[model samples]
Target: MDASHHPCGGIPSRLPGGGGAPRPDARGWPKGCPSTVARERIRVPEATRRVKPAAACIVRHNYYPDTHVRRDAEALVEAGYDVSVVSLRRPGQAAREALCGVNVYRLPMQHRRGSSLRYAWEYTLFLFLAFLTVTALHVKKRFRVVEVDNMPDILVLSALVPRLLGVRVILYVFDNMPELLAYLRGWSARHPVVRFLAFLERLSARFADRVIVTQEMPRRAMASRGVPRHKIAVVLNSADETAFVPSAAPDAGRRDVFQIVSHGVILERYGVQVLIEALPSIAAQVPGVEVQVFGEGEYRRALEEQARRNGTTQLVSFRGFAPFDELIATLARADVGYVGMLNDLVLPNKLMEYVALGVPVTASRWPTFLHYFPDEAVAYFRPGDPEDLAAAIVRMHRNPASSRARARRAKELYQDYRWSVQREVYLGVYSELLNGVVGASAMGSRVGAAPYQRS
Candidate 1:
């Protein structure tokens, strides 16, 4: 994928291929760099001046190497939209950069943990920087759309200035923010801050020109919160098939004895505790059933302590956060991949990624999983039920043939979630916005085939 060539419309003079040296991304993550995940291809006719080039500005608080955002920007660019992303600094990113044809600007900040002071400082700084970026970019470029990837739910404000400038704003929600924070803190909605956040969330949803949610439950949740059903679109959080390709089966010696893997944030909301509590029974029933827990989060320490207390610390290993290839390789070796969420309004992205990897999954019996895996591809265990989780683990370990069969079935189901299809749906949203198509059913009809809406 050459950054020089536009996938959809004729090349613009501003793009590097037609002019002087390409603008060096201040962030180390450079555009068209081999190290970054490339966007999936989707064909759109070269956009002419008849349609104004839509400018997309993404506002995200916490950052990851998001392939969805990358592909979303790429699709808009291919369709002749000028793309600019505004996000907070992650570990290795520079303050600014151009990535695979997208303008990415980072707000610099000191890393802080869970202190209220830190949260205030971070959000305040992000808000200030974001407003500056939006004002500067809009003055020079004609951006007609602003996209907010929700985790903090504060990104919806990014559209305020743009809307005042007559640009449309789309809120792209990946997780249910209020519920996620409550899950993380183990606090209930009764908490004052939780209540305040819920209020803010409802207000944000109301302000968005269009709302996008990852799962059906969140879409319903948004509607319940007073966001009209017609203003929302169900856009799922998906893995880029371009990055997580299937690899050759590993040599027997290279695989764990009784391999089990779980990715994403290893936190309580993910039900890592159930896996922790199941470890002792699983170890006794199937000796040397080593478990590999990937990603880092609040629950990591608790899980490690539980393993130690149960005397199964030797049997469990924490791989922390691995890079892209290592994470995929780890997934490829998993005999039984785990997926879970504390009954939330959104599905976990890992469920789709694991399924795409063709691994037999043992997931919590939640509406989110049920929505995705109606087939026997996913083996259900009672949510937070350690005994049930242990039994499910032992069953898969005992029946390798059944596990492999489930893996094959899961892969077949995941075929619908290919990046090409996902990119097209996203582009449709941008096209709708650029063409002044904002309604209950923008773009004429819903993207019914999105795998995130599995049911």
Candidate 2:
């Protein structure tokens, strides 16, 4: 878990002090020291020496501390692969650092929300920088696999050099770009620009040796777009249970107030406004009802205004982005977790985290939500309908026993998609692609298992 910072964009040629044989650190410096300190001779673990050296890199457009990217990178490290993540450099973050056994190399660029042209320019610039960084890292690390997570699906092109060098490339589709674009731009799916994104998506998928998607819906979406079905694998973004523990029994002191929590980027499509609109009805039915909004984004200002206009300003509190542990603590205390997305395609990770913590959830009845959570496990409301959402919340508040029972059911259903189970599935994708040679033993008896073939 030790991390060392480097100011340079690429791997440092040598440590700070004069030369000696580079030593392996706890975070796995396979060839060279990740730290800049003087080298010293140290005993390498037998397991480390016996295992075939496999290096992998993940290229993501976001900053470090990204839950999905961190989970995947750490899983690789645990499976005996040296993992590195290439991402954006946010303010006050190190240019290069090792975290939780994964080495992170952040570029100089920052992510900003703006017009389509601005987005295009930023994506293009990051793509170019990533290509250069990955090419340079491969020269030293010789990564056996390069995985790219997408906002712009074409980021997979950053690995072109490595792909040409016989390294396996994986395009991990976090979201269906075309569908997201259509939703954000209010354009028809058949719009020329949306269709162009679909074209790029297909090309990206075809370029990768395999594609990893969050769930079955996106996998099917990719397959229908001419990306071969077998080439795609589903890796659910379930909560890391070790960090997100189930809440202790309800406190009698908290019974005076109904606490509802929703956390994630505050975008219009996420439907936070719908939740705010429902707050008045919820408070009227269940007095002392309070809503905690966590995380910040472009739509926050408008959401605050809407809360004020609805006369529910006191009922709703916007608690901006908090640390992971703090967020989990907040979720654990909630009487209900709210997911009010207008879009049906995304399976929100926040929903999974809520379930993981044994928090009762009232979620939008999106196809993706229904696909994952059975009717008995969650109380679902019509998406973007304030009245239905309010009714759902009131019902849960009035029927505490039913709410807890439903939460229990959710925890049970979550077992099928929790991180431990999905991590193996994720590693299996790499194992299968590498011909069952790399990390095959980590997959245990499922070594040759067909890469998560569940439809």
Candidate with best lDDT: 2
lDDT for each of the candidates? 0.66, 0.76
Residue-wise C-alpha lDDT for candidate 2, range 1-455, written one tens digit per residue: 00111100011111222123443322112344222121122334565565556889999887665446655776666566778899988666678877656788989988776788888999999999999999999999888889998877999999999999999998988778788778767899899999999999999988998888888789889989998776777888776676577435446477788999987666677788998998888888997799998776667899999988989888888987554446667779899998887877768878888898889999989778888898899999999999999999999999989999999999999998888788777888887777744333322325532212111
After TM-score superposition, the amount by which residue 386's alpha carbon in candidate 1 deviates from its true location, in angstroms, is 1.4
Q: Write the per-residue lDDT of candidate 1 for residues 1-455, one digit (tens) a residue.
A: 11111111110112212122244221112235332333234333344434445466777664423435555666556555667887656555566777657787867753456576667666767677777888788787756678877655776776677788788788877666677667657789788878888888888777777888766788777788888877787655666566566556644464338888877655466677788788888888986688888766666899889889888888788987555556677778777888755564556667777777777899889876677676478888888898998999899988878887887887776776555565566666665665656652432354321111011
TM-score of 1: 0.82
Count backbone overlaps in model 2. Answer: 0
Among these predicted structures, which one has the highest TM-score?
2
Off by over 4 Å in 1: 1-52, 64-68, 90-93, 185-192, 250-256, 439-455
lDDT of 2: 0.76
